[model samples]
Target: MDKHFLIVSFLFCFIVAVTPLKCVTCHLRTRTDRCRRGFGSCIAQTFESCMSLKIFQDNILQLSYMVCQKFCRDLTFDFHNRTYVHKCCRYNYCNIEI
Candidate 1:
């Protein structure tokens, strides 16, 4: 009985450890800061992380995008009078507040 219990416990731990991270996903956010389209959740793969991207035009926020990104990197850039900020996180739902 002890051996069986130990094996089951170990398996449960292993499964939990190997489970992929979950992240909030939204493709478009409205001006009122509400999800406008593609609202859902995603399970991140081994090479992926949760990413949030915010776009600002003339210092006013214009859009927000969130998803599970592969090979994610933190960055900020400007293009065509708009600034884009990209942020990445590893834990589950870490990008929720971004």
Candidate 2:
């Protein structure tokens, strides 16, 4: 009984640790700027690594805008959808796109 309880507790802790819970304070967007940059066309290019993460912690809007530019040269977007494709950058964009 003691061994079973210990194993169960360990499994429960492991499950909780591996689970990806959303950050209520810092929810990251799943959008990618590839489509905005003409990704399917000849002008399309890969996203820059330097712009992968936020440049300024305080200014999320500015950082996101700047990062979008690394993929799309045009920064004057009318809306978020116009600048980035929703839920497109969730995983392995470089490997899949290239």
Candidate 3:
């Protein structure tokens, strides 16, 4: 009985340690330089990162958004002379500045 209890306790600890955290989700966009207020709930899943993205056009900032992400490479991409800035974080609701 002692051995069984020890094994069960270890398994429970491992499960709790590996579980993912919940993160807030929201997107903000505006062509006129004003984004409306929005509210969102936390999402708990296998995703281990929260990401914030910002895009700019002709030195004028365009879109801003945030989402729970599965991968976290922390890189940026550009297309059609437009730039994409990507940032990743590990804490819950840490994808601010979007």
Better of 1 and 2 by TM-score: 1
- Per-residue lDDT tens digits of candidate 2, residues 60-92? 333221122133222222353333322112122
RMSD of 3: 5.0
lDDT (Cα, tens digit) per residue for candidate 3, span 4-59: 99999999999977867655565785656455444364555664577777787886
The number of the candidate with the highest lDDT is 1
Per TM-score, the best of the predicted structures is: 1
Off by over 4 Å in 2: 24-98
User: Which of candidates 1 and 3 is the stronger one according to TM-score?
Assistant: 1
- Every model: Cα RMSD to truth: 3.1, 13.6, 5.0
lDDT for 62 (candidate 1): 94
Q: For candidate 1, lDDT tens digit of each residue in 15-71?
A: 989988999999998669899998999999989999999999999999999999999
Which candidate model has the greater lDDT, 1 or 2?
A: 1
Cα lDDT of all candidates, in order? 0.93, 0.31, 0.71
TM-score for each predicted model, relative to the true structure: 0.81, 0.25, 0.61
Look at candidate 2 and give me any clashing residue pairs.
Answer: none
